[model samples]
Target: MQRVKPGDGRALKRFRWWQSLSRALFHLRLMDGDSGQTVYSVDVRHQQHSSSSGRVVAHLYLDGRHHAESTVPAVFPVQGGTVEVRASTVGLKRCHYVTAEGAEFQLVPDPASAEGRRARLDRSHPALSRCMGFLSGTVLVVGVVLLALQLAEQITRDPEGVAQYAGTLTSPIDLSGWANTVVGLCTVAASTERALRLRYNWLLDGAAG
Candidate 1:
């Protein structure tokens, strides 16, 4: 555990390796209500339990002080906005702090986390990051297309009236079971990487999930 500052009331969270696949950390800063010049920080960690049905916890901090906490979907009232957090099996799908004026901003990860490292990479090497992002989107799109074709073939193979109207369908990229397993794993990795960047397309990424 790390403190936001020396003698600060709240314990700043440090990312752990074991939670790499199941945890997300985010931070937000705002003007303090009590002090005009002092700024406050809201730190939140979305940690999911190991079980499939386990719940996720969102811890909120204010000005390095423990302010409030809740489980998804969490809503914490703060200066000029409300901090909201949401989670999924893969990690956080939403962690935006929305202002009263309708402006929205996402809380980024702490500098020590894996997500933070990736964000730093984007800042330092934008072209590479963009390429990786595009690659992830492409992978998800391919997965979605393959899944749709397979589903269509499966549906048309046995159905009578539908098959008669649409004709029997066949997937163009048929592969062995081992090949499919490799593709599935690659798709999952792509989706997870996109999730780290907070980039998601419902049609493409959802199908991968």
Candidate 2:
């Protein structure tokens, strides 16, 4: 990244709740270009949420100082590489700093954030993290299957020529209204939990969301 002098890293903005579960802050540390003794800091924020107005921005800092800012799908020039920040409908799916030499590393998460907590859990308890990951995936798979079956029923219920060829189909498992609501809620929770760990499967979590 271009070193923009010492004092530029001022007026750092505090985090906002609009960040939702999809927001994440990461830090990259590197040495300065001019003076080898100086250290530069890069901070990137990825925020994705349904509540947002569709604007995404990433901020860069030098020595804990604000240096520059750019919108998501952003690229920040750094010492030997660039930091790329990206987001998806539910959360960040990509946030990494890539070097000119092709080596890459993810930024460090802020200790206070939910993403940070999830990262900590992964580091401290790999087994538990794996179990939770598997559970989330299984939940999403169930949701996908149910949704597909329901859609199939809806498609075949109306008397149509296609139904004659395809054969009438009805969902074997029917859920009451309240049960449907509960399933919806559980699907949302499962997707959110998966997002916390930056785990996303387009067919599973995408459909669940």
Candidate 3:
């Protein structure tokens, strides 16, 4: 009969790395506003019956809700990278945008979230500037053509009102007025849109949109 030795190959550590199964790791991040986007992250590890000093993975919970058990992996697991999880505020009276684990990290610590908004006058100003250049060029071309046609028609025969009207509309004074007006209009529209969106975002996270 063969005799087994003490602490031999038959003896094994229950939580040994070799004996543990590979598990999916994860982390967490949360949003603090209406968009419910990710704002923060947490590190965690597998919830297995092993050494407490094993690999680290993230554990997640949505808005203080019991979304998962203690051993369940988070939505975005990461071994040595960043995790992304949203702070869900659904089914609450006036959702408070907050992470399930931490405080707010706003754009400047005023309230708790970033004001994802752009100044209207600043927003469409560039586009208007670019479009103004284009429209100016179009007007120049049309004006030149009209001027040439009018000159030819008048120089050879009786002149008509079409040339004058075309010239006036494409003139420097008219073009400048139109460009400025267009820029102002677009600036207003873009700025308003940015403001509205930002306000909605702020209501939840308590920051400027």
Candidate 4:
């Protein structure tokens, strides 16, 4: 096998090539490349097989930032072909792709060897769930307060009898606004929790490096 130095480009351009291949999986990483920042990196994952109908795709990476991904489909007529990619930017460009080379390929997800991303997310923190509960409770409070205010307003509207409930008027929360706020808060909390879990897992797996 031979290596080639395919130098710098833009942020989303691909910069490497696999001239020919058959039945395999591969990984590519750019340790440092791009014009925006020297801290950027990239990783590409390609999986192909004899049974695969198309070429294995090499997901793109710019200065470590994930911008685009596409699979190279396996072609018919039973023949070999080239796979290529590029780097977008400049600075110590390491253009390399890793391939899983072996015979008797078997498709399977290794459990013991598999990284437990899902389980880790769930076991992350009680704070996330509790924050969700808090947003739900806010909805209840908003409803109760709005209902009480509406009732008082209705009672005071009676013409004949004197309206006894006299209090300073000021709306605490709008119904629609409260609902939207609650929903948004919950969504943000959930997303944040997920992001935190993912980052933590990556760090654990040494992928953050």
TM-scores of the models, in the given order? Answer: 0.82, 0.76, 0.17, 0.23
Instruction: Go through the candidates in order and give the clash count of each.
Output: 1, 5, 16, 22
Report the C-alpha lDDT of model 3 over 51-114, residue by residue, as the tens digit: 4534232233333332232221223322223233222111001112233454422211111111
3 or 4: which has the higher TM-score? 4
**Which is superior by lDDT, 1 or 4?**
1
Q: For candidate 2, list the clashing residue pairs, or say none.
A: 1-77, 1-78, 1-79, 9-65, 9-66
Top candidate, metric TM-score: 1
Look at candidate 2 and tell me the lDDT of residue 40.
40
User: lDDT per residue, candidate 1, 70-111, as tens digits?
Assistant: 556667776787777766555566778899999999887767
lDDT of each: 0.71, 0.70, 0.30, 0.32
Off by over 4 Å in 3: 1-124, 158-209
Show the colliding residue pairs in model 1.
Answer: 41-63
For candidate 2, report its TM-score. 0.76
Error of 1 at 122 (Å): 0.3
Clashes of 2: 5
In Å, residue 186's CA in model 4 sits off its true spot by: 10
- lDDT value for model 3: 0.30
Ranking according to lDDT, highest score first? 1, 2, 4, 3
